[model samples]
Target: MQNDLFYQELDQFNLFSEFAEPQHYQPVPNDWFVVITDVVNSTQAIQDGRYRQVNALGVASIVAIMNSIKPLKVPYIFGGDGASVCVPSSVLQQVKQALQATVILAKQQFSLEIRAGVVPVSDIRQLGKDIRVAKFQPKDHFSQAMFDGNGLSAADSLIKQANSQYLIEPVESDSLDNNDLFEGFECRWNEIPSRSKEHIALLVQALPNEQFSSDQIYQIVLMAINGCYGDELAYHPITPKQMSLSSKVADLQNEAKIRSGFVGKLTKYKYIAKLKLLRHVGNYLMKNKVKTDATEWGGYKQRLVENTDFQKFDDMLRMVISGNEEQRVQLENKLKQLQQSGLLAYGIHSAPSALITCMVNDYNHDHVHFLDTTRGGYAMAAKQLKSQLATLKSVE
Candidate 1:
């Protein structure tokens, strides 16, 4: 009678058959692990106003070290105040070494301290399940006890006991319950803040795709900055001068590599040249010191002509090449005529936009402006007059 009743129930619903299927018992792969690393005292650091610089250095160090660990495909998620990484079981040791190196590098370069913990999982599905279960449990007792007193409430005491046990001996489990038998199993699944979930999701999505080279990854990070801060606070629209400068820097770097036996020597040279050029330009601006808008245009033009860095005055200058060929040729002719007639003065008593526009159209140039820290307006402008001279030459 009992067998007959079971059969009747099975007949009424196909759920039993579904459960009995072979696919339901398929084994889960046990070769995945997660590492969570948090930057220590990040709150104090941000309050100290060292957050941006320190965070950049820490992330750079971490990424560089992670890239060196071979055979291990790891996904690194940056969580603002910390980062998390996932790796395959086969390369667990390598991942550990990389994490250690990241900590060491961060300390050496940015004076930042980091703490990391690892957990192994049979598969991604198991990991998700375990995390969900862990999150449901309470996990912050020892910290509370330290601040309050030696004695803790029932929940706080339970958490502290779990933490102490976990610290003494690490264990991996699919499920841990808050019972008397498992008194020392504090759940830290909630250590990863909710705000960082999006970043974690992005890291997971980026995995299974081809890994990017260091330079490529750097570009990806810089591009992400625009989105990091909302559209309102993002950088202004990229100017033509900015694009041209970036391209020229890349070319110069590539050229240095080709010239030398090394593959990336040009990158170093380009950086050095950029530093030198900026210093010289800054000095010139300080020396000229245009106070009034009236004399600003003439003062800037005279400085550009006198400055050796603006070598390609006519053909391929920086600011003047944005316009068409006819406009550029006209500007060149006007500049030449002014120089010949000796009417090209060093400063303008009163500058007008029409004159500036006419000069730009004639020379086929776009002006590069820099923020004047002392003066509240855009007082410095560079007219890139030559196209081929896009690359800045090293002064020394």
Candidate 2:
């Protein structure tokens, strides 16, 4: 397909039904580029209680790139500690420059080192790998790119293997004017608590080709849990009680409050107050139906409740869920049953609270969040899970 037709066709591609299948996704255009960004010492920072910064940086990278390349739709994912974005070749140079600025912001503002790069999808294919993606809407205006095959992993590995010329290198800079790209990134709410005040950040992988399709095993696993834990919403961590705004005025830094000038500091204060007021209004709307110019605000809350980001899949099915110790045990036991059947590999990290990082483009619309446990963080948890899967490799 021509580039223009390809872009238009991808916007309409839809074949998967009920559950997304790995095979249904088509290869991304070879001319497009995959830009991967992650905090270099995110695991340590999360341990230092700077989990919010890690999450904010991941979302910030996305906001920066998207804002720079408006009128273009990019496919991306917020991976707890970082993000992966695939942009069309047309904005390749612009996206790289935007990401470079973000790397500088992450370091200067949050004191976090971020690694980012623009990698050509064609180069990945040249390495005998391919990029296949299916777009799925966990929520409207919050579209996620679902990956398949080995290419996504190949591109990611190349990006992180070593700093290359294509990397979005951070420049030494004292200026903080354009650092406001993270305008919507917020961590105002305190860590969400489970009813039992205990939560688990989980990573699960279907044992590759163990006499079963990976997608089949995934469905069975989810069905087993839905059977045990009740409906999907029941296991969602964002209960009405756990949802509230943090009133700390100092938390605005990760929201990308610009501070290059005295005027900027004053502007930050005003935005902080606006955020607090919006939080109160959001809390009220969550409980009570209120009419609005667009639609009822309460319905939006219901939509958020129903469209929780508790579980996600890339090459692995990963989750950060809120529940009691008992609930954790119940899910683990089922997973063990699946494991014994040579169907999957699983790892769990227990935490007291689940952290949320939000990207709020509009008050009433275009809001999405990335959720992860603060303890070991999802990146570390996923590493452990992948190691287990390698040991339990099921070619049997």
Top-scoring candidate (TM-score): 2
- Name the runs in model 2 displaced over 4 angstroms: 1-20, 138-142, 172-180, 256-274, 277-290, 336-343, 389-396
Per-prediction TM-score to the true structure, in the order listed: 0.30, 0.85
Kindly list the per-residue Cα lDDT of model 2 for residues 116-227, writing each as its tens digit.
Answer: 8778888888999877777666554445566665666777788777547667666655445455545555567777777656767887777657478877788887776676
335-354 per-residue lDDT for model 1 (tens digits): 44432333221110111110
Weakest ten-residue segment in model 1 by summed lDDT:
141-150
Q: Which residue pairs clash in candidate 2?
A: none
Backbone Cα, N, C clashes tallied per candidate? 22, 0
Clashes of 2: 0
Off by over 4 Å in 1: 1-29, 70-72, 122-396
